[model samples]
Target: IVTVAGNVERPRNFEVRFGTPMRDVIVLAGAKPDTDRIIMGGPMMGYAMPGDEVPVVKATNCILVGSPTLFPPPPPEMPCIRCGECAKACPVDLQPFEMYWFSRAKIFGKAQEYHLFDCIECGCCAFVCPSRIPLVDYYRFAKSEIWAREQEKEAADTARERYEFRLAREEREKAEKAAKLAAKAAETKAKLAQQEAAKAAEGTAAPTPTAGDDAKKALIAAAMERAKQQAAAPLNTENLTPDQQAQIADAEARRAQALPAEGKE
Candidate 1:
């Protein structure tokens, strides 16, 4: 059921099918000559249609018309005076004046903290604004800006997480490589120690000296004993007479001649 009202010759309800064009509805109702604009719904909450060619949807309950006397152009927007009328008219009990100030100043975060999205955009606050400030428009603008910023922040957060993860992965790889190198070095050191230990064991297992080496060591000991005995024998010749010294010298010369013959033999 489509209800056509305002600036029409016949302001009455009509039963129509779905997807009906707005032009057909207006023609059925007989649009007035002074109808300047066609609104999709009520005058207070409805949106003015840009053209009549748009088809009516299921939600199109009312098709209102606009005229100079019925729906005049909105007054020029003015700055808020904190009159508190918008706050009073707010059905949601929000502070529209504060929202207006924040939105106009582009302080969208503050606007969100004040429950800006909770506003139904009912136009009640704008209706009561003494300064004719478009409070709802400001609220809408703020909401859009906040949403866009949230999207950008989400993207940034995702990128940061990816970068941090990559850094962690690189650190883990480096640590793993270090561990592998350390293990290899330790293994190599253990092998070298084992080789040194094997060599030491082999040295301790070597054979003892043979009989020939023992004979050589005995000869050296005998020669050392003879030298000791000779050193211990005192020089009694120091106190000997001349005849005794001459006899000793003649005996030494004879011993020297015999030593040379033994060496030749």
Candidate 2:
């Protein structure tokens, strides 16, 4: 639903598709030729749109057409005379002047301390300000800046966590590999020692192949097979589209071609 009113020849509501352009809506309402501004909401809270080319999304409910005569440019901002008009006009009983001062000075923490978020942005403060200080605008700027900084902080924290996790996983894999190598070396050394003892016991006997050597060879072969199996583990395919599954298959095929056969390097 889009409501095109104020400065249009015909002011009314219209049900249109979500992606309908703002210009089309304005045309339906007979927009004035000299429309100076096309705000996206009510007079008080609406933002003046850049142009009518923007599309109407789910949130677009109002389009306040403006002209020079209907909506004149605001007077140059004058210095605040420390009047209590804005505070008195505030419906939430908030000290608008204090928040305004802090916001203008870029002291957002101070503004928040003064209950800035409690402001309903009803435009009462700006409307009643004798100084004509666009106080609400300052409050909006402070809120947006704070929110943006918080988002950046969250992104930085997430990246740090991912990096830490990757490092831990790499370290764990390296430890496991080192432990396996140490065990294999210890087993081979023990087998060789046993073979030397047996040959010494039989003073003049020739040293032939032993079952221990064959066992050692089998252990190495098993380790290599386990490594290959771990490397070629199947990937999770749940919730993937047909195209995504096909892409994964193609990638795996390429990887298989790049890797050598199990027995070779």
Candidate 3:
């Protein structure tokens, strides 16, 4: 658990009393009410509690009381000479100079490329900096900006995906319409074919033999012949000899030659 208070004779850790007032803890630790002190968590991350009456909740760690001596006066701000000392002292080993430039210019994207998210906010860079520039604060601002941009990017991607999905749905609807039209055309053609077949069955004056009907009959006859051959495998075609082969060839030639005469008839 985190605890905080001003000037204590003995600093307590893991103090289990819940909803305790900071004033009570200060009194318990023997405070000189006469002395002016600014107590914070640490020199780095902590800020002064507004008053001693403020109750310490779960987050209070250490109340660092700063008199004139406890927290030293801040070093005067000076111009950064681009010296590499702050870069060396940085725990995250960030390029402080480049980040400093981006922060100064408010160029958040470039700062992110330099891995602004990796900064631990140690304030070591500020401490080591000759210019006393708050490098940690810059990293903090950069991180916030990067987070905001990422959220925006995610929103844009979600919007794009929704648009693409809408387009796909529209295309599918168009394709379904086209397929229905094609099916209707095919059904109409089938109805016409059925009517023609019915007319032929009624012995209309039109010729009964069409090329398609002849092809169908020929295929059926061929299938039947193959089936008969398969059923009687021991049949001896070799015994017929060349004369039988010649005769069969002559019959096929005769049929081909008779086609025009048959069509005329």
TM-score of each: 0.55, 0.74, 0.53
List, residue by residue over 115-205, the lDDT tens digit for candidate 2: 9888888899999887888988998998998888889999999999999999999999999999999999999999999999988889977
Candidate 1: residue 31 lDDT (0-100)? 92
- Top-TM-score candidate index: 2
Candidate 1 residue-wise lDDT, 1-265, digit = tens: 8899998999899898878889899999999888888999876667878998888898999999778988777899887788899899999999998888899899988988899999988999888888888778788889999999999999999999999999999999999999999999999999999999999998999678999999999999999999999999977867899899899999999999999999999
TM-score of 1: 0.55
lDDT of 2: 0.91
Model 3: per-residue lDDT, tens digit, 1-265?
5353445565565464657776777666666545355455677766666777776666666766555555556777677899998889988888887887797688987887877777777778888888888777777777777788889999999999999999999999999999999999999999999999988888856666889999999999999999998988866665787989999899999999999899999
Pick the winner on TM-score between candidates 1 and 3.
1
| Local distance difference test, each candidate | 0.89, 0.91, 0.76
Task: In angstroms, give how far residue 99 of model 3 lies from its true place.
Answer: 1.3
Better of 2 and 3 by lDDT: 2
